[model samples]
Target: MTGPTVSSPHEVTDLAAVTLLVHDRTRRVLGAFLGREQTVAGAARETGLDLRVVHRDVQALRRAGLLRVTREQARAGRPVKMYRAHADDLFVDARHLPQQAGEGQAAALDPLFHHAVAREFRRALSDFSPGWGLRVYATPDAPGFAVLEGPRSARRLSPLDEWQGPPARMLSGTPTAHLTTAQVTEVQRDLILLMRKVAEFSAANAGAGQPVLLRLGLAPLTEDELRNLHR
Candidate 1:
């Protein structure tokens, strides 16, 4: 009796993250069980795939280095294999992260992940926030961070929907100038969605805390504006 294999939403997203070289449902399914523990029957049930099908996918993922048998058991006159997600094979953390251990690991995978996330976010905006503008910006001076600015006119933002996991702030700034209630709320919100979405891509789910998004607000000041604001 082989333990079951299971798939998770996080696993599904991981496959999408590193799909540049390969895109197969089996690989994705197998990646789900690599580092994490799972039983074959459980994985079959979770992924809504047949036991035989899941087994095949697991085998395929092993060959790809996306999955490996972490453990095995014997019961009912047969041996059962337990699958764990292989660290090397996973491409994305549900937190929008790579499995690498470090601060700002997301930055390491940014060139690739950023484009994909931006594209998904843009597509999401079309239906979720029609008429809203999403801009992707990176400054040489701003290292280990990525920012997405929505149209200044947008309303409240909800990170629960936007971010795949919890997000936390690394650094935050206050808006130098007082903004209208709508502007204030909108800026505060969309900023949260974008950053929190980015934060979750780290090590949170794997003993990392539940994803928390960090919100930063800045009001860029002109020379004269700065004088007035200070006064």
Candidate 2:
């Protein structure tokens, strides 16, 4: 779906440009290179798209201000230009979005929080070893959190316990809704408190133990996914 066409001429113009990038093929190209830098040939290889097609889309995305030249490779013939999706994510204003009061506030805040997290996560990945891996948390009971842990490259497929000694990890709550809203709030508050304590402990014990990139997030679950889970 396209974003809302608004009053400002510039906003309308910008929306049109962004809508083009949301086309199927262009979207595929963007997804293929979203988190990593790649040459046109490399992107084509990754997406199984024709090189000429990738070349055209990449230029279009560049002009639309979605992709950027990350760097170039000195190939035998021409300097191979490397491109990457600079837009970590996109936000489109939908007029039909649920109009419940405060939904707009939450909608606006969501991207700011998420993109900030993405920026930090990318920074951590770039600096950490390759064995680290992404861990996702979800439940039907409440909003879930995702944590990134490390010592090795996240790109590796090893299980958490196998690599280094067991780091301080905790998981709780169930996929069923047995608790009241107050109970859920209490659990969330407790989790945050525990994490704060851990931060204090971590700061005091920094460098004395195995180094790891620790993170946590709590976000709403998609109703559609929860429905699928029941099946």
**For every model shown, what is its TM-score relative to the native structure?**
0.31, 0.35
Best by lDDT: 2
Worst 10-residue lDDT window, candidate 1: 164-173
Regions of model 1 farther than 4 Å from truth: 1-24, 92-231
Q: For residues 97-124, could you state the per-residue lDDT of candidate 1 as single tens digits?
A: 4444343544565455445556555565
Model 2, 23-111: lDDT tens per residue? 66888888877778888888889889999998988888888877889888897998988888766656545552234535666777767
- Per-candidate RMSD, Å: 17.2, 18.4
Compared with the true structure, the alpha-carbon lDDT of candidate 1 equals 0.57
Clashes of each: 33, 9
Assess candidate 2 and give its TM-score to the true structure.
Answer: 0.35
